[model samples]
Target: MPTLLTVDIGGTNCRFARFSIEKGALTLAGTARRQTADIPDTQALMDACAEALIAPGEADALVIGMAGPIAGQRRARLTNAPLELDLSDAETRYGVGACLLVNDFLAEACACLTPIGAGAFPVLGPRDAATGDGTIGIIGAGTGLGTASLVRDSRGAWLPLPAEGGHAAFPFTGKEEADFQAFAASALGLSYLRGDDVLTGRGLCLLHAFLTGERREAAEVAAQGLSRETETLRWYARFYGRACRDWALSTLCTGGLFITGGIARRNPLVMRCASFRESFYDSPQRSLLERLPVRRYADEASGLWGSAWLAARLIGALPA
Candidate 1:
């Protein structure tokens, strides 16, 4: 059996896990988490985490799922974070045979292709039994909006496709949405506000201020749990559902739509709101979307799990 090191790095925190592969099965051995701010740079963070989590040279390979766009093949940089990853540096620093870096949402999408446990729950349309055969779509809202898809290759293996769909222009549904867009444009000092401008954690704060003329942190607004914030939450859900539907339609993700990230996972009520489903099954695309299964990626460790799976495949412990 070979052991692999898996890392899921986000804006606020980073999660590390060790997985042991035996007989084509991956098992979680140990896990640790640390705050991202506690480290100075990517190398320092990885070094500290690796030292704390695993015995030197114990890991056969390493896979890192990081927030933001991944640049370069052998060397990658996270768009929103101040870290750069070079595979050669990582292999030497971590004492691993090989290392791979990928977009965090791509890892989440990979998780969707695996067998989900009880952590996942239905938040929208009925669960479809045939979800295993087709494409899967994923969108998450946290520090930013993340989007990705999983499509089966000719060999019937699911491959993750990562994209920067979050930067796409925010769609406007009506006059109210247009008005809100105007407000976002002026407030953010931009001619165009992308999906991240209105679908992320900071976006929620912007929404609260725009609707109530009272600025409040996203966490504070969520904690208030007041009726005044219901409309804002609904708006968020609506936009979220709209984005999911668009992705579903674009990718023909009949397998399902999985919503992950801090906002959706921490605040499940927003996803359960009627507005969310309404926007998801909105008229024109209702026929297509209604048949697709939808589930929230409730497990916080999904990215880590996904990374482990990728590592197992890379090591030939699992069929590709």
Candidate 2:
């Protein structure tokens, strides 16, 4: 089986996997990942991936799931990477004929079309949820925030819609704007709203810093089992809940709201907190919001599956 090299890159880490199409299904072979800060440039990263696979010329195509925006058909660059990645260059470097760029979260959502492991049940809201036409929403809080939608078309196929929802202004709900504004003014040096500033891992840290008066990574706060009685931790939980609620309202994810990413899934306290549900249903349309089912993307390989699926489609190896 010819290999397909897949890379899932985020602000913090880079995950690489090798997949081969087998009898109409994607089978994983070898996988490796590295931290972004450790790598110096794009070439080095790609080289590391090639080395991990141990077969430089075996892959038929390369699929990159990047944290940045992808545009046009032939070339793309990373929004956060200091260096630019030209996909067409691969024709010479790897002798590969094709390259594909896709949003990392979109890949994860597409992977959800397949069966995954258990999920963290979420509190979903109702709006236009009906048979055959309702939309599915994915809100992931990881190194950063990621939002995507799966809309069921008339033909009944789940179509993926990718967008920069994380960059959207963080809509303040009641005192949320006030609290967020204060945090931003004091830390970020700007009071304007940013969805990532509140919905991401760093956002959680920012909230912790404001309430706890200590600067630390959000993942650390949740991992260390910090004193829940501390006002800072309490405030962080409240804000986290509020952020999830806000996305739920915007999407009206009656089909269901999926919360994924490292920060969200690792923090069981955040999910179990009563405030999380309360804030989720705190909207004026609580009755409508109460009916939506919510869950977390439990499968870590979900993103890898997405990349492989897209690769199969682009190569015309699978029916659309």
Candidate 3:
């Protein structure tokens, strides 16, 4: 069985997992997590996590999936954190023969292949007939909004496509919501409100403050929940549903739409709220959305598993 190391780097913490094939199935051998702030550099980040999971030079390849746009698939600077990676020295520095760098959401897309399956993640919608052979959409909200897709080709292989759709303009409906959007834009000192600021933790804080006038952290607002009682989470759910609907429309995701992120996992009430369901199915093209499946990968380590999946295939991509 080929062995490799896979990493999932986020704005706060980095997750490392070692993978091996057992009876033709990819298996996670060991895993570890380290804070980005604690690791001194990229080398240290790799060394510490690798040491935690495996012995030196035991890996055949290395794969990294993190929060950043990859340039030439060899280098990147994380958008939400101070970490930067240069994979040119990966073979010599990490003692791995094959290496790859990719967007975190791409890794999420990879996870859709083997890691997600029957009862693997929660189906947030009423129906789930996802055979996962069509174009799949993946989106999430954490330190920032993340979006990606796994499009199935005529050859029936799912290819991960990265996108920065999170930075695009956020939609606000009605005069009340539009006023809040203006307020958010003004508060953040931006000309237009973007999804990065609308559907995340900061968005929760801003929404709470606008309604209650008593500013509190996102954690506080989340504790109130998205039930009929809590206005903050209801509005947040509305914004979130809009994001899902728009993404589904754009991608025309017939396979399935998977949601991954801390916000929903930490506050599942938002996903269960009536407002969320209403807004999600409120579009003119609601029939298209109704046919699509919606699921949630609640495990935070999904990216790590996804990275391992890619690392397993890295050997085939290496030059003969």
Candidate 4:
């Protein structure tokens, strides 16, 4: 059994965990999280990664899920962080022979493949309701809207499908949606809503403002909850729900809607209040969207777990 170092680099936080394969079971050694902006360069990030790995090994390799698109086998265009890193640079700095770099959202979806109990993860329907297929859809709202699809092969192992679904233009369906888009176009110079624009935490604030004319940060509105109700927060909930519903329908997520990311977790008030089901089932033909199971991952560390799993798969220790 060999130990692997797994890293998940987000715009806000970078988390690393060590896992070792012991008699066919992957065991967690330890995990650590550090801020991304605090590190100046790739070298500093590698140093942080080195410190995060706990077990004693010769440092076989590293697998990282970065926040931006990865070009070829190396190089990443990070969305939030200023630094763009090459995989070869990371391998040289960490003294590892190989490295795997994947988009952050895809990594999160891979992480969710592990069988987490119903208690650890909130379920929207029966466990048997997941369609018994290897297919899964993931949605995350952080600095941006993140999405990825997962397909399990005959071996029941998860494989991440690369997608730029977030960059897709948002489709406006209702009168309110048209009105909201008009406001955004005049205010933000956006011709049309992007999936990232309305699905993110800041997007919530944007929705709140469009609905109420009062502009406030997403954090403040979430912190205030319904204590200080304004027309804005109410609209924010509705818009957010509708956006989620649309995404679910577009993805046809039979496995489940695994909602991770900072914004989705913190804005419980909005999720509960929003007409999520109504908007979700509002499709013209509703056989799929009406029955889609939506669930939220309360634990934010699932990405790191997925990164570890990715490392094992890349190393040939675990089946893909």
**Best by the lDDT measure:** 3
- Which 10-residue window in model 3 sums to the lowest lDDT? 117-126
Any runs in candidate 1 off by more than 4 Å, and if so which?
115-118, 128-130, 225-229
Ranking by TM-score: 3, 1, 4, 2
| Segments of candidate 4 deviating more than 4 angstroms | 54-58, 115-120, 123-131, 153-157, 226-234
Q: Which lDDT tens digits does candidate 3 get at residues 1-320? A: 78878888888778888888777677878888888777656778667765678742578878889788999888988888788888777777767678899999999877877656444465455464755577888889988899999886677666788998899999888999989988888998999988889988888888888988878877767776443458787788889999998998888888888888888777777778888888989989988788888888877778877777787767763111
lDDT per prediction? 0.78, 0.68, 0.80, 0.69
Off by over 4 Å in 3: 120-128, 225-228, 317-320
C-alpha TM-score for every candidate: 0.93, 0.84, 0.93, 0.87
Clashes of 4: 1
- Per-residue lDDT of 1-320 in model 4, one digit per residue for the tens? 67778778887788887878887666778889998887666667777876766421354557778888889857786776697777666544556765788888877887665543132344343444543473677777787778887877677766687676677787676787788888776676777778777666666666767766678987776676433455655666555566666666666677776777887676655455545445555668567655666677777777777777777778888777
* Winner of 2 and 4 under lDDT: 4
| Model 4 clashing residue pairs (backbone) | 111-306
Each candidate: RMSD to true structure?
Answer: 2.1, 3.5, 2.5, 2.9
Q: Which scores better on lDDT, 3 or 4?
A: 3
- Lowest-lDDT window of 10 residues in candidate 2? 123-132
**lDDT of each residue in 208-228, candidate 2, tens digit only:** 666657788766766653335
Candidate 3 TM-score over all chains jointly: 0.93
In candidate 3, which residue pairs clash?
none
Of 1 and 2, the candidate ahead on lDDT is 1
Clashing residue pairs in all predictions, respectively, total 0, 3, 0, 1
